[model samples]
Target: MFNVPMEVLFKVWRQKPHQSPQLQTYKLEVQAGNTILECLNRIKWEQDGSLAFRKNCRNTICGSCSMRINGRSALACKQNVGQELEMASSSNNGDVPTITIAPLGNMPVIKDLVVDMSGFWDKLQKVDPYVSTQGRKIPEREFLQTPEERSQLDQTGNCIMCGACYSECNALTVNPEFVGPHALAKAQRMVADSRDTEVEARLETYNQGTQGVWGCTRCYYCNAVCPMEVAPMDQIGYLKQDILDRKDAQSSRAIRHRKVLIDLVKQGGWIDERKFGVFVVGNYFRDLQGLLSLAPLGLRMLSSGKFPLSFEPSEGTKEVRSLIEAVQNHD
Candidate 1:
């Protein structure tokens, strides 16, 4: 509460799915400490009852009021009007500010600030994000783990399925089948759980091209927009690394690419570009088709004076190798 209410303009985005959106502005007398959700409720109650959005817990836990406030994804309940006003001030406006609100991106809007999250949920389902229960008789006891084993799950298990990461995902904007950041984040949870017995099979499916973790662009937008600090992109990276540690990592080209790069860098203090393609795509010179595919590109690079014909160890190569060795030993 404040001594007086400040008048700020709310530029809200209005549209239903498959319909043209309109910018509807409301002039409201609000206090500095008001949450965006509170302002929205006031607008709906006092001015426009038809303005549709979603809300449940009103606290940050439920995440129902997730939306774009000023072109960034955030929970309305967690952000106060005073902070937004400060942002407006810092933007060099210095005057009474206009705040813009819109629905989350990369998902179809149902109406106003609400979006259809069916695609988000569908992608999650494709990951099979649970430990398999087969091969064990039901015991009258809970599966147990030490605190160390259980701690790995706590970070990912905090996800609320808010669809925040999925909405801002760069990969989903181009490739529709790309398993979203949210799904992969949760998938990492299952992968790290000590009780899960399907690591190999799960990694195999997750390696499928453009359908699983391989499809992520690693733009890290998923990490930035996630209100809960789920760091979906980091979890996806962890899954990739864990997959590579398994015996079957080399079976997938994506995994092979990552492994080969690290190995080459470790051996030579940097990549020996000549061996990179053959070792990775050509499967250690075993895949004739992969070698044939690279021949044309290799010729073009050679002709353009861009191909590496000889390998030279970088200066301080020994030091670099020692650093890498230290990290590996620690891991």
Candidate 2:
């Protein structure tokens, strides 16, 4: 932390309900020890009383201060002015260094640096984040879990529902029905709990449509911006693995896509684009509707000479197959 004060430019996104949003710049001389939240507080207290944002503990725990800082979602309370200035300097080409603050993405803004989290909460509810009702029946004492079982819940339990992961989720941006990473991370927590009797039901629900775990595009943006180091994308992967282990390819096109992708890779060390669509989306021509849905894309690919007519096995196919089999066996 620098004791010397430095003048930093803050470009904050300003929007009121039913108003066009724009950046409003604020100049402040701040010490490096001051957090982004502190600067925001100073701005509101001294510079602009009309400025709107949310805060609670003035620390990271409450997660109320989550917003975009320098183009990425994070908790403002956790970010120091020093770190942001250094980051801004690197990208600013020696121009005046500036920290850009905006409300979290993938949610509607209520005001400057504040977003409506109703959708975030609704998606979280869809995952049924609570432990199974059966497991919660009035017990004589606390429900117990082994050390190993408890360990599995540690990372996901760290989530404070800050909406950072939700803001960065690419799938949620395009597919409103897609439950964001925050929900799936919580779902994984419930699934990992030994006391949860609804394990199968939860897995089935998570495996269901684009709204569930299958919807994740694996962009890893959620993981990158998570404040608590929850690594939500990794939790989503665990959910997928659990479903893939129990469910067959015929369960759903999503399952088929995963199974076929792995099978093709095992056979040729990489996906066979030609066979992939047939087996996955088309379900080997068993589903006429699925086949019909592929017609437009198939015709376009063929017309553009982008369709592969033949398949060639990779030189390391045997090694790839062995590695996959080893993982399966270990599991």
Candidate 3:
């Protein structure tokens, strides 16, 4: 059998007593089949006894070995060094596959790979993740659900609390108060559960504040890094649809914003900035302070004769509206 020789370098985080973070490089000759987790274990056991990292079920299911590998969040146990090296070698950039293992971002680093999950746990607690019967006694028999009903909750329950989505999420980076993707996914799981009696209340909780679904920028980074394949962006979109269906009128800022943009596109086959700004920020007559804020920029555009009061309809406006109607009706 042909064996691949490995002499990879690991740029790992080193924590010393009463000091800030530091990166320490370690070189090792690993076998072809060795995983990143195995290499780290070898370094800890044979090379440096003080090296700190977490590994429980060596399998990917545990999610304990999540860290940044080659600038992407992935489970160390599942990552093959030889394959990563091969890809790096073939790339035009000639960037060698140097493993830069660090604690998952957006959470407090307790040690090396281990992050303090109190913040994550707290956000999850805020959502009240468990299904609430609300003063009802459970019967001896299990709750019966149709296959379709069961599938909705089952789709989101695959999340392993790995923090991969949290690390890649842009909303978490901008709004620290926003309940990150994992908590939202968990909330979505409960909201979709057929046995859950508090779907409306749960929906309200996710829509109430800035930390709610409105805060999500829909970057889809969470969908990419999720080990369980649960698309939090899709969950957020469904949550928005559910809220809109129920006519939760109070949370209509995003909806109004969306409608204004949609209507603009429908009328002209493109967005009308003047209308979008008026709708988004409110009417100019009603909100003088808001209109004044944009006065200078608006004047600059007016001076250039580019700021038209309204736009003529595009050639394909009717076709665009038909496409929109078709999609909604199909859904």
Give the top-scoring candidate (TM-score): 2
- Cα lDDT tens digits, model 1, 1-331, are 5545888888899998789999998888898888999999999999999999999898889888999888788888888788887776343234657888999888888999999988878888988987765435666657787999999888898888877788788899999989889999988898898988888888888878878888999998889978788899999998887776774535778878887887888788899999999898899888999999999999999999999999998887888888988977886
TM-score of each: 0.87, 0.94, 0.88
lDDT of every predicted structure (CA atoms)? 0.85, 0.90, 0.78
Give Cα distance to truth, residue 300, candidate 3, Å: 5.2
lDDT of 1: 0.85
- Put down candidate 3 lDDT per residue, 219-299, tens digits, no spaces: 998998887798888888888777766763223556666666776787788887887776666642456676677788889
All candidates: CA RMSD in angstroms?
2.9, 1.8, 3.0
Score residue 166 of candidate 3 by CA lDDT: 87
Q: Which ten residues in a row have the lowest lDDT in candidate 2?
A: 88-97
Residue range with the least summed lDDT across 10 consecutive positions in model 3: 88-97
lDDT of 2 by residue, 41-137 (tens): 9999999999999999986899999999999999998999888877763545245567889999999999888899999999899988888855456
How would you order the candidates by lDDT, starting with the best?
2, 1, 3
What is the lDDT, from 0 to 100, of the residue 16 in candidate 1? 81
